[model samples]
Target: MKLYFINEYLGDIHNTGVEGMWVYAEITPSKNIDKFNDFFAALVDEENDFEEANFSEEWVDDNNWFVIDDENRKKGICIPAVYPDGVIAWRWR
Candidate 1:
């Protein structure tokens, strides 16, 4: 899985920034795409909040993740950004 961080502003407040990160996983002949999608979807749904979200200590130590806004706490992460190709589905954080 390839991870990308897209920096963008959230909510009406100016100067407050957040990362809209996405994961891109290539499906190959040996890969089970359905299972992969289901796993990621469930994981995202379960740990949608920044405070409640779980990440590896190594990942956290290496990279900065999402920052939740007070107003958008209920919005959660893992919004799907669909593309025409259908293979490139983004899990927006």
Candidate 2:
């Protein structure tokens, strides 16, 4: 399974239920792929530590990360910008 490092925000915008805020970190690969099992284990441990340190939410059931601001708004999802990271960009489709 491929791993992704993401930042998420949870908040409200207008008169609607808001998923709030989200932010993503630079997603990097587990370097030591030779020891895939151990590498994944270490990654999991590191991910847990990171969650505890920052978002307070574990990287589990990574579905439904965000919601729209108004009930009438069409359902859409946010995705990473096409350009390089740290570009302060987004593609909401």
Candidate 3:
């Protein structure tokens, strides 16, 4: 399993009124970022609920959305400043 610092909440497809929070997911990393984006684009958790985030055709950018970190250190609330230049991948748990 790989670790990812993700901002899945603020994308165009979903939201939870908490855009500043990030999820440190220990997931099976995806092969590529496109696959990662597609997987999440279709992800809709009923338990979590996204029927109010106004579903869209797109989400975050492949080059600017997330980063894969095994050590689990990426500040989503304050990014590019605290953590600059890191490998981004589609992490799955």
Candidate 4:
């Protein structure tokens, strides 16, 4: 099983009434997201702090994100999204 972590940052300029940040993680087949269709949904339940967040699939860069004590070795992939006020988003897949 593998853990996928996803997050989004809505910067000060978004003005979408979105603040702070979001984080989510789930366990699935290693390096194969196709094996876990319900992964994102599970994360919504797993990450109680960010229940309102959502996930979208895309290619992520490796420069904008990092793993903090990722014992599962699942933190590395980074999907980059540019938000207003230089906000950066990332997802580990």
Cα lDDT tens digits for candidate 3, 21-49: 33332233334433344334334333553
- Give the whole-model CA lDDT for all candidates, comma-separated: 0.33, 0.30, 0.31, 0.34
Off by over 4 Å in 1: 1-26, 29-39, 46-53, 60-93
Tens-digit per-residue lDDT, 23-64, candidate 1: 443322123233234333443454464332343443233133
- Give lDDT tens digits, candidate 4, residues 1-88: 2223344321121222223443333221234434333433343344464332343333223443444432534355453333222333
User: Cα RMSD (Å) per model?
Assistant: 13.3, 14.4, 13.5, 13.6
Alpha carbon deviation, residue 58, candidate 2 (Å)? 10
| TM per candidate | 0.19, 0.21, 0.20, 0.22
Q: Which candidate's TM-score is highest? A: 4
Question: Which predicted model would earn the best lDDT?
Answer: 4
Error of 4 at 46 (Å): 29
State the weakest 10-residue window (summed lDDT) of model 2. 81-90
**Which scores greater on lDDT, model 1 or model 3?**
1
lDDT of 2 by residue, 1-93 (tens): 122224333222322222335333332323432223332243345345423233223332234233333344433334322112212222234
Give every collision pair in model 4. Answer: 60-78, 60-79
